[model samples]
Target: MKTDTLFKRAFNDALLLTSRLRDGDPIPSETTLAAELGVSRTTVRKILQTLTEQGVVAGAGRSRFARASAGEVQPFPEAETVPTSVQVEKQFMEWMLRGDAKAGALINELDLARQFKVATTVIREFLNSFQRFGLIERRPSGGWVLQGFTHSFALELFEIREMFELRSAREFSSLPGTSPLWHELRRLRQEHIELLSEIETRFQDFSDLDSRFHRLVNTAVPNRFIDGFFDIITLIFHYHYQWNKKDERERNEVAIREHLAYIDALLSRSRSAVATACRRHLASARQTLIRSTSDTGSVA
Candidate 1:
């Protein structure tokens, strides 16, 4: 199933690329296409073969050429190309962030399956994953129940978050000057500047930026556990940002500035500075989460 999704996504991308070429234009080489699509050469070959079978391309191997115009072929629907788990997770998060699910609310697998356009089993699996974090609990009869975001849970979660982020920040500070992370960091810094300039209207956009920035920091030294924990953090923070609307703009503006300082510290390559900046930003985040939880009384 996963492979099929990957192939469909790659095929759609290839189709888009082919559409941009004039009729009879030479198809890119397999190696070139693989690099462009960020897929294995074998996948690229499969995509070319599929394209040939669909009458979208003519000839074979290096002699292949575009045989159809953009209007002749249709790309796969955007949703069909994404894995069901990913789609379900995204829908679940959006549902929670939209305030559709309250603390201690029962999770209706059938309803969620219908809402997300997925199967009941998919919703069950997603809820099961959340069970480990105590964010959801399986009911005796069936289905699951959403848990509140308790103050104690917030403290414990942020404690681990700080540890992981601080370690990642320290590793980032030690990264070689030639590392690509430096380029990404610079680009993110520019994005932060742009967002800050228009913060009043764009403050709501900070949730995604916050997630991206932290994810990049974690890239300095990848750990599967850290990556998984970050998923929870992203969802919780996203929920908090949405649920806590009072002073939302001010809160996000402060966070953006803090991120800039954190970025500067990492760029400086100073261990002490990185540690200080990481802790400071994390402390602020901890406080914000605490405040939100207190205000909502949503978390037990």
Candidate 2:
């Protein structure tokens, strides 16, 4: 079976097996399912989680899943679709970009919690992730203080980002036609084209779109360590750059075209071509970061 079919086949097989079993009947472990279905345990786990989410399965522990009472699977509502954590991150980034807060300013967790309409723990988790990069630090007195960086910091981060993405491009070049990545790339490419066609009205949305595009590209590889760095990169390049609105629309239009080129190169599955495309886009992002630092006129 094709890699794309692995997921659906697992889900369907699990559903079929569950249909014949009583509610109290034990479901197989992820390891058992993966072995039986010839799929990865990761894939099996994902399907099980979906089944649980859709009310087809029940149990808190991974080892305890069993069929739920028979009922129609609820179609998840499109509204309230964004995960609380993701929405929190978005709002927090926006809060920073909107200049509601500033570099060197103290970040009050309770204040942020109220602003984001989330618990203080969620706010702490969001900020704590950035603490790894020294982007934010806890004040000796109390709350967290947002840290500012010199231009060198941005350049260094970009260098690491380029290395990871170039490797990702090389890996992506070898993916088979049945890879789910192709479907994602096609969808994102269409989105790029649509946004470019309406650039006059939609250019401001490019920052978010650019973040998504790069995030998707980096996700092609299975590097867990890079995930944390990617989050900081996304926050800085995508949202931080919003501080400077000079030539914003034109810059965004150019970025949209560049993204389309990157998507095209990936689809061609040519390592050299993808490398060139990736280099070009990363260079653009680095330049944008430098410009943002200059606009802010702050260095630490």
Q: What C-alpha lDDT, on a 0 to 100 scale, does residue 239 get in candidate 1?
A: 65
Q: Write one digit per residue (lDDT tens) for candidate 1, span 109-131.
A: 89999998777777888888867
Q: Pick the candidate with the highest lDDT.
A: 1
Q: Residue 156 in model 2: shift from native, Å?
A: 1.6
lDDT: worst 10-residue window of model 1: 291-300
TM-score of 2: 0.57
lDDT of 2: 0.75
lDDT of each: 0.84, 0.75
Which pairs of residues have clashing backbones in candidate 1? 148-299, 149-299, 150-299, 150-300
